[model samples]
Target chain A: MAYVKINKDRCKGCGLCIQNCKLALLVIVEDELNVLGYHPVGFVDGEGECKGCKFCAETCPDCAIEVYK
Target chain B: MTTEAKDKPKKVYGRPESLKDVGFHFCPGCNHGNVHKMVAEAIDEFGVREKTIGVAGVGCGVFLYNYIDIDVLEAPHGRACAEATGVSRVHPDHVVFTYQGDGDLAAIGIAETIHAANRGEHITVLFVNNTVYGMTGGQMAPTTLLGQKTTTSPYGREFMGEGYPIKMAEMLATLEGTAFVARVACNTPKNIMAAKRAIKKAFKMQIDKMGFTFVEILSACPTNWGMDAVTANKRVEEEMIPYFPLGILKERTTADYL
Candidate 1:
């Protein structure tokens, strides 16, 4: 039972988490709060497969991603 | 009761008796005893005693195998990093850590130390930097202050000949592979507690499958320094602290832990 949470406030718009997620959980959404002019973070929309490995969280520079199982 | 006299009762607070008790070989009032106790306690706290493997160095702590209850390995003079790498890599599930001194680490084994951090080996390192070599009388180490006299330098060390003290934490913290790097002193009760936390966190980082973790523990060798315990402790505050301030030099949150 792996649950994932991302602290959006810590996101520096570096997009490293999205690049490292390995899972198709995160998506880039562009809107008013996408201050970096990019989709900062979007969670797994329908929860297909997460693996719960937490590679993205471990590699995040700004501590933007969190995962607990 | 004499106002100026008090006897400390012998206490059995470290490891359990089932592991076959063996006493340490440290000098009287040596800080190694307290460090051993704290390391033992850290193992117990993490419940890894049964699965913990301790690597001993070639300094005064060479006989550390006798004191700790867990499985122990004796590394060659300044080869603890090499030895620990094997143990930790082979047994990834177990908690592996190495205990080394200033002479062993900052002197001869510097290559292995840097490579180990660069490789980001998943192991804990308990670094004891006492400035002077403890096992072979008082000789200058890579960390010996500029003017501190030792057997090797009867006169205060000359900067032209000896070079400056190496701030290892700062050097290692700059590496991109190291996950956790902190320096802590083990002189007072408060500092001891902080040291324990630093050590435990290093272990926990490994358990969490994080990368390399190093805790440079500032210790004292009163016998080798030709000073009493009180004076040795005082020197750690006055001389050592200035060079190696106590704090988390570089630490990452769970999100940043790798």
Candidate 2:
């Protein structure tokens, strides 16, 4: 199983992580605005089946995402 | 969080210790943040945080000192290489590097950068090429694509009025003093990994007293490009990569020198 943490305050909601998430596990939480006034990315573990590829983390420009496996 | 769970789950990715606990001021999805993280990771991996001196150039990257926790000297517009030269000369044992934007390195500071590289100064240079002058509100830069439109070139860059984009990597590779030169991007996961490798090698070459090292990062200026972060990233992969062609342009080994 894998887990990911998205620092809400630091997220710029650029959606780069979501675009790179191969599993389509990341989504922009439009309903929730971050401290920066942009919608931040939310991670859906999807039955805890993350591949732990770290693609989302690596592609994040804001360094908002942290991944653990 | 329990200690057991913390120990059980291996952290795959997180902020490097070399990076300060502060959010970047770059626009959403700006490539500078990714590049900064890669640099910090390189510094951490090499354990050179204390010995590293970062020379920040004018432009958006001027605030590099704020992000990376290290001794940083803010150089005047386009003088990062010149200042880095002095820093490296003073402390030959320290790791000296300069972070510069396209406008700073390719435009105003071109002479300083070229001269430093020509002299084979033992320093590393991190050049971020986003095509336009991002900090100055998206002006036409020397590296701007011929047809690209910017605040300065509203009618689109015409070949007659503006020359073709300068290929800094190829230009620097022709210099005899340079030990390594490579072009990388931060648009995708695979590309980011490649960028990290290039940056690490650049620093390593400097540490080994090889000569001047350069890593040209084809970054994205989403706000200046007037595109969303994702679209701007696509532009880097689809447009910029075609012109910049990523890879190592030059590498000098001891065997070649001897």
Candidate 3:
């Protein structure tokens, strides 16, 4: 099984991960603001298993995503 | 998979040891952060973090010292190559590199850059080409594409006045001094991986004492490009890649004379 962690403060909310994730498991949490005042990426739980491909983590400019398998 | 194995996840990807724990000061969706991460990863992989010295050029990447936890020297605008030449000569055994932006490498420092490479300075150079002077509110750079609008090129970059976008990788590859020369981009996951590989190879070449090495990374400038992160990345694929062309332009296993 694979999962990912996002550091909210580190996230600049560029949405690169959201766009690049093959499983489409990440989304920008629009309702709340992170410490940096940008919409942080949130993992949609149980929707799909993260393949551990690390596409999202690699695509993240802010190094906010940490993938675990 | 076993339940215990599933429960306790092994970290597959995270921050590189060579990078500082602090968050980046770059704007949202800027490519500098990604490129910085790659460089740190390369340094960590080589186990040269302690001996590696970075010379930073003026531009967005001027704060390279803050992100990468390595000894760094700040060079004057477009003088990074010259500074790196001196540092590499002084510390012959240490791993030395210069991180420069397009404006610093292809514009103001063009003469210095060429001369250093021509002299076969034993150093590595990381050229971040975003095609615009990002830090100064998006002024036209030597690598700025034709028909691309910037603060200075309001109407667009015309061939008559601006000539053409400079191709640093191909240009530098022509010199006999360069051991390795490549152009890579961070627009997509695959490209990002390739960029990292190229950067690592460039470092390896320098470690092998081949000659001057260069890697030109095509990065996106979302804020300066007046586009969202995703769109700017798309522009890198659509516009930049076509003109710049990716892959290793030159690689030498042994010195030219040998």
Candidate 4:
């Protein structure tokens, strides 16, 4: 199984990961903001398990995503 | 720490060791941040952090010294390649590279860039061509595509008046001094991985004393381009790539050229 972790404080909320994810499993949390006052990204509720592709981590300019498999 | 947390798999991606643990001032979705990470990763992979000197040109990339944890020199507008030349000659043992944008390199600094490549200065150049002057607003840059609109070119870029987009990689690849020349984009995961490989190869050329090396990255300036981040990235892939085709334009073998 693959697990993805987002560093909320480090995320700049660019949404590149959400847009680039091949699985379409990530989304931006619009209800809350990070320390930088931007919407943070997270996996969608009840989404399938992460494929461990690391595309989200690779696309994140802020280095906010970490993937473990 | 909880037992479950301790049993997690190994972390696969994180901030590179050569980067400073600080926030970037670049706008959200700016590819400069991504390029910075790639360069930092190259430095860390080569273990040359202590012996690397980065030259920052005027433009949005001027803050490169802030994000990258290396000895960086602030050069005048369009003079990063010239400044890098001086640094490389003075300290040939150290790895020298310059970070520049289209306005700073393709337009005002074209002379310096061409001359440095011709001279084989043994330095690496990271060129970000976002089709406009990002820092000083969306001015029409030399790399701006034909018919592209900018703050200066309000209507659209006219080839008769503004000339066509300057393909820096193709132009530099023609020089005998350059050991490596590639153009890559950062809008997609596949392209980003290719860009990282090109960046690493450019640095390796410098370390091997193979002479000048250049990598032009087609980045997106959403703030200036008047598009959302996702749409801007899409433009890079759908529109820009067709005009600026990506790949290694030149890669001279050490034995044949050097």
Q: lDDT, candidate 3, residue B71?
A: 100
lDDT of 3 by residue, B64-116 (tens): 98989999999998999999999999999999999999999999999999999
Candidate 4, residue B13: how far the Cα is off, in Å: 0.7
lDDT of 4 by residue, B133-156 (tens): 999988999999999999899889
Residue pairs in steric clash, candidate 1? Answer: A29-A39
Which residue segments of model 2 deviate by more than 4 Å? B1-7, B255-258
Ranking by TM-score: 3, 2, 4, 1
- How accurate locally, in lDDT, is each candidate? 0.75, 0.93, 0.93, 0.91
lDDT of 1 by residue, A1-69 (tens): 464676554344444446556666776555625433333566774754766665555433233455654
Quality of model 2 by C-alpha lDDT: 0.93
Q: Write the per-residue lDDT of candidate 4 for residues A1-69, one digit (tens) a residue.
A: 677888887877888998888788888888988999888897763655677898988888888888877
Interface Cα RMSD of candidate 2: 0.7
On residues B13-72, what C-alpha lDDT tens digit does candidate 2 reach at each position? 999899898999999989999999999999999999999999999999989889999999
In candidate 3, what are the lDDT values of residues A6-68, reduced to their tens digit?
Answer: 999899899999899877899989897988899888998695477889998898888888998
Per-prediction fnat: 0.00, 0.94, 0.93, 0.74
